[model samples]
Target: MAAILVPSLLEVLVLICLVSTCVSSKPTNKIKSLNVIKELNRKGKYIGLITVTATEENAFFATGAFMPHSKHPFVDLAGRRFFVGKVNAAATTQQLLDHFDLKGIIHFGIAGNVNNSMSIGDVTIPKQFADTGLWDWLNPNATWDPSSYVAELDFDNYNEPNFNGSNNLLGHLGYETVQFFSESGDPNTPQPLLWAQVSEDWLQVAATNLEGIELEQCVNSSLCLPEKPKLVVGLSGSTANMFVDNAAYRDFLYKNFNVSSADMESSAVVMTSLSNGLPVIVIRGLSDLAGRQSGVNAYATFGSLAARNTAKAVVQFINNIYSFSSS
Candidate 1:
């Protein structure tokens, strides 16, 4: 089985909302969310700690006395206001970020990986993301092409001057994309999708502080990971809507891009933050090996464990955030 799990409720909500820009019809859940937004309007937060699933939510905020802000998820932690929601899709992630103003955005969730260096329970802080599987179908006959539709994504010219280069670990990066035939659409000339990067200052803080943090290796006595998990930083990854299960594709992505993780939503989150001129950081735990391992699909076996590691990493990240703020 592929590492891809069924579409999460958040993903489904995003897909449905996209059809009507989140106002197609009066759904019951929509009413509840609207009410929550009204309540949130009275009081929202500064930093948003985003999660994509119940598993991730429980891992981080379960212990806190968090109340739903107008029926949406928002909480106060350590003198900081935080919001946790199932922003599962890229569009949903952007929607949530825009819906609520934030000083910085942090994403903590589970991801797929085939990098042998990382284990199913390991957590990775990706410094940069390379988009894959997203393509612009450029017709050769068309003379006027949208500027967004280009031969390659330009990441070199983009720089973060405000990052305070003292801790920055980013530089000229050459991101890659693939060309292939889509089953639904006509065979078209493919173009590289969007490429964006996370803030180096945020990553450097995470790398320096959480570099050697201990990771979980077992969810329970009955089920355990094959190896101990570790905290990895400054790694790269590929993002795509489709779940990757093929070892060849995983190897190709890792070998080509030197990515340590794979995800469907991180790329979207990165682009959204970049668009808003915010420094977005991603903390993803490996839930599966992307078909590299022959045993049971690890997403089922180690999903919560991965979520725990991500939550732990986020706690550490948040501690660092406070330290930096105070300094």
Candidate 2:
């Protein structure tokens, strides 16, 4: 009986060991798969070229060299290497940074043209970017108070053409700007909060170098813009998750924010890059007038054209980035 027990115990112990080894090896294999490869780590400093959607990426790729490897997201482009930040905002921006060391970041996408002076397919490189996603809904009886906590949007005052005030309950919305504490700030103590801004060095370089590059006026030969698309610099840009399709809301944003373009992702990229002490710039193509169009919103018709034009501007910006590095 003792001899039989001993052999049985030995067999059980061996099986247990085998099972533990296999279980531990699984995680090890996973970790190994996730580990950054030698090729990615040795690429040196690369520029981050980010796009918010497949259309934008395809348009950007159309302009020049794009070599993508299965191991990483880095793409070789136009005699330079770039870390491509995939779709969406903060998460994608952080992902690019986590994977590769980048010299600077350039975010490009199609946007609703809040400034009516800008036409569809035109591009704008705003100097300042703000995430206007934070908001407070006020009651009809709420007091009109403006403070650091709340910047009221006076939609009632705008008197937007054809706005049916009888059915409008959106007049009480208030905008709140995001504030950040310094990385060194103590959790228990009060610290001054700050807003993020784009890198002036990069902005200056783009402004000086990419002024007159002709933008695509048409998606195809028959669907040309009424006028040739233009590149405008040094305007303010705002971002929010909500798409602005109401003419009254568009007028409010234009009047209150003084922003030329509005999009879903730019401010997130700007904030993330600024927090990391990296230089960044955003190049946006006006896809449609944010709710200002007389007909059904034109974004469905011209979004691709605007994206193509923005890509052209981004390509030109990349070619001239040496000026930024030198500065």
Candidate 3:
């Protein structure tokens, strides 16, 4: 009786193992992880555009139309001009590599202004960003607080000529312009004006790091009505804490890093792209200058403008890449 019972038990255990293996090996499970890659591969050697909407309102405004992508389960923005997607640093990096087999990635979105020199509506292409918020805690001997890191310009401090090299190329094309906060400042009030300039070398390095790909110049947007796309680049930072409308914190950032802009998303974007060897480009518009006196309604009013400008820059950037690839 004992021997018979042992054989029956062994049979049951064998069945269980067989069932588990079958379930684990199913195509459904593999598809789940590889879904994005499969769809992108289907498109064949195409440029991938990634736009992030940190808030629902920003998402809606950035996309121009609210719809999810048919393949990737993300919102579609701007007439399906680009796919709206979400991924943490690790996952985003993996997904791009696994699914799209993409040649490059363009990150378009809005960012807050940390530098007083930048005005709302100005689009900034940062050459380097300092993660001044809180990463130092990880290192034992680091002198600065763990909260933030500053991005240094690739060029020398006195090298104004090099720093502004891309400006002439973009400015003559009408891409660089100042965006005012508001016109209602009283005669006695010293109104704040924020501005953004394109960081060319930064973009080149970022694109190289993120995609393991190099950029080639394409047709200029100013030359075409639909606007030909040109490769636009800049430096951007990432922060762990939300940027509350605080003056002291703003001052801290300004004094420490010389960061011209602030945003919740770019650091993650850059870090992930760098890690995965994907091409990443950020075009951030200054929505709000950090400070107590900057004004209360700045976030609400200028956030939309930042989103719009970022979208335009991204679209043009993508178009430029596509043109280069095609040619």
Candidate 4:
């Protein structure tokens, strides 16, 4: 009886080991198969296309097909052309990686012009996008002003004495510039101090053209002009809570930093791209000056034009890059 029991135990152990091996081996092959399929699917799709938009009115304008499919429209810009599709950041990024397999992204849209000097038609390419909203968590001192925090930190302070000259009073003025400089590094310098310098330079040229200027003379001409657009490469803040939209808030944003623009989505976009080790560029047209109810009216009045100009600038950048690459 003892010998019979021992033999049965050994048999059961062998069966269990066999089952485990088979189960593990099957999953390994299945995973490899799935990965192969995914790679093959990606290879078969489009490559090297771009996505752009304006207001809802002109959102589909570039695509040229009103009521177009969500992510399936193509358009031509001047002679330099690329594909246009609608995609939120995540979906756009994924689709570009998966289907189009794009080399990079060109995010163009209208943004509220916080900089007092920024006119309605001016275009902005931000360098670094701060999630001002995120400060709610990182900033234990909520009493500190949001606008000031952004302005002080966002602009190009390299030439300024101690790099502390505040564009803060400018309202969103330094926002895009600061964002851009932070991401691309100082455009005036040689090293890749930031991530998006090449794109930013392209956008700056486009902005100058859109503004119909031969040169973008700096307010402080003594300071070397930044060759690239100082972009804030992230989503702009969209606050859940209500705060005073009056002069006081604007003053705070303007006085502390020299921020000149604000948006709900830019900071998020920048953060996402940086984290992924992808190049990010932001092209925003001034839609409104930073303020409250009155500011909203101002934004509405010029937002459309700002959006349109921004779109054109993006097109210009694409053309320039294409020309350089083809050359």
Candidate 5:
């Protein structure tokens, strides 16, 4: 007679996991730094996946998937892996990559325009991302100068000589950061420190293919923009949870950082990507003037047009990504 044998507890758990498609806890990182790539997968081959993340429904459509990530399984397109995941923010993106072997990350969406010269529906590829929400001095009595908000404020200009950087405020990143918000209510922060820099290779590739791509002037049958949309590249972007809709604030951001676009998510996403030594690119189309203009919010009227236009440029980039490491 054959000897009776029992399955190990690990083998039984694996069996149950197969029957139920549940997401297992992500594997831990060794260095515990933001730059460290999280565990790809405990099972199956690690496929070097190149993914484009978007934060909204309109932007998700740009990923070229016909169905949501829940209903449809991941499908490869353009000779590379193409899959759409739920919108990622700076807060959650660091945790979502455990399932794939990442090669590069691209994010696309609509933003409030900070540059007055640019109109609604124009797309911008931001050159850098800066966090504008931080305050150097916790004291309520400490006054904020209008020029103090500039990203390049010199270190000597800081009013508080004792103020250290915001390291304690944001902790546990694997790599060093070059970007600065402000130093102890002093406008004199370091100059030429980059908060987030887009990949130059990707930009060089995109600048050629993305040229002359037409933008949608009309959102739908019911609404239309006043002028034809255009495309602009290599501009700055700013981020804070606070909504920027006033002309004064728009002027402030544009003057301080040369910021062309302002949004809630891109800065966070860019920081997360760069911290991990991952290449990241941001494509933003303007749906509103970020309250720079008067009247009803154009986001309701022009958001679709902006999203579609931004996606068009992204699709163009994805279609020709033959040089990416994963590809």
Candidate 6:
């Protein structure tokens, strides 16, 4: 009787294991832990510090306020901890989320300034981010079919001598915006969202506290900007995969989206943060005029200065983050 009971119990346990495995096969639509995650719940919440390039990361830590952890990839300053994610591209930004349990994210880097009013080394904190990469190229010689595409750019309109010029190379190029659906929203009835907004509460704190912070105006004695660099808050920024070096496209982005700055990764990072329900903000310093300059692009010359200025603002912003989080 005892032997029979033991076999029955073993069969029951095997059936339960199989059932659990089958049930877990369905997609959870969440980031699964890739490794045995060490629990940091006992330690204080840590914020994420993300940058696009090595130059940006070096400039950020140059502020001298942060102390690197002896063993981990974290930095400590003023009793606050931050996880440094200094990889390039948007996919890495998503990977960071998978690896660490971060309370919030702050992305800082250099960007091309579309706003002609803003000068090099000026830091901008945009209120929201948009992906300007989506587009459909139209046939240049095809008849004007209004139904061909939605929200077309019509490079013909910008065919001034300075833009498309007589060559009309961009006559077929059309620009479009991307539409994203939320994972948390109803699967049966989903809503498409266009813009990924930053944390309003965090933006308010920045607006109130960062206004008085001064920004760098010069790379050196000879390379100084004509005007002082100022911190401009509450503007919109555009993000895409390609580097923007065309004056015509830069003007189009400015006229269409009214974006203060443009970069390669900010939109993706912000969108990921928004999807995870984490507070996120972007700090981008203007390195060039986005081809608005008369000659070659200014990024090569002013990139470091712009990165340093962004770092300066980020350090101050982190110092104030504690108060906002506590409240």
Per-residue CA lDDT of model 1 for 135-248, tens digit only, reads: 554333444434443233222234457655443233222233533232333557543444467888888889889988988787998888767888888888778888877777
Q: What would the TM-score be for candidate 6 when compared with the true structure? A: 0.75
> Which segments of candidate 1 are over 4 A away from where they belong?
1-45, 63-95, 136-194
User: Model 5, residue 43: what's the lDDT?
Assistant: 22
lDDT of 5 by residue, 1-327 (tens): 000000111110000011122233333522332232222122212111121222243353454422323522232211222232222111011123343344455666778999878999999887778776653432333334534333433223323556564323321111123453333324655443436677787776677777678878886777778888888877888877787878766776788667889887777766656655656677788889988767877787777778788867765665444334334
After superposing all C-alphas onto the true structure, candidate 1 shows an RMSD in angstroms of 14.4
After superposing candidate 6 on the true structure, give the runs of residues whose Cα lies further than 4 Å from its correct spot: 1-44, 73-95, 141-150, 158-171, 188-190
Error of 3 at 303 (Å): 1.2
Worst 10 residues of 5 by lDDT: 1-10
- Ten-residue segment with the worst summed lDDT in candidate 3? 1-10
Instruction: Please report, in order, the local distance difference test score of every candidate based on alpha carbons.
Output: 0.60, 0.63, 0.40, 0.38, 0.53, 0.64
Global Cα lDDT for candidate 2: 0.63
TM-score, every prediction: 0.64, 0.76, 0.51, 0.48, 0.62, 0.75
Q: Among all windows of ten consecutive residues in candidate 6, which has the lowest summed lDDT? A: 1-10
Model 5 clashing residue pairs (backbone) = 34-174, 35-276, 153-189, 154-188, 154-189, 155-188, 158-186, 245-290, 245-291
Task: Sort all candidates by lDDT, best to worst.
Answer: 6, 2, 1, 5, 3, 4
TM-score-wise, the better of 3 and 4 is: 3
Task: Please give, for residues 200-290, the per-residue lDDT of candidate 6 as tens digits.
Answer: 9878878988976888778888888877788988999999888998888898888878888999888887887777777788888899998
Question: What is the TM-score of candidate 5?
Answer: 0.62
For candidate 6, list the clashing residue pairs, or say none: none
Q: lDDT, candidate 3, residue 77? A: 19
- Scored by lDDT, model 3 comes in at 0.40
lDDT of 6 at 127: 97
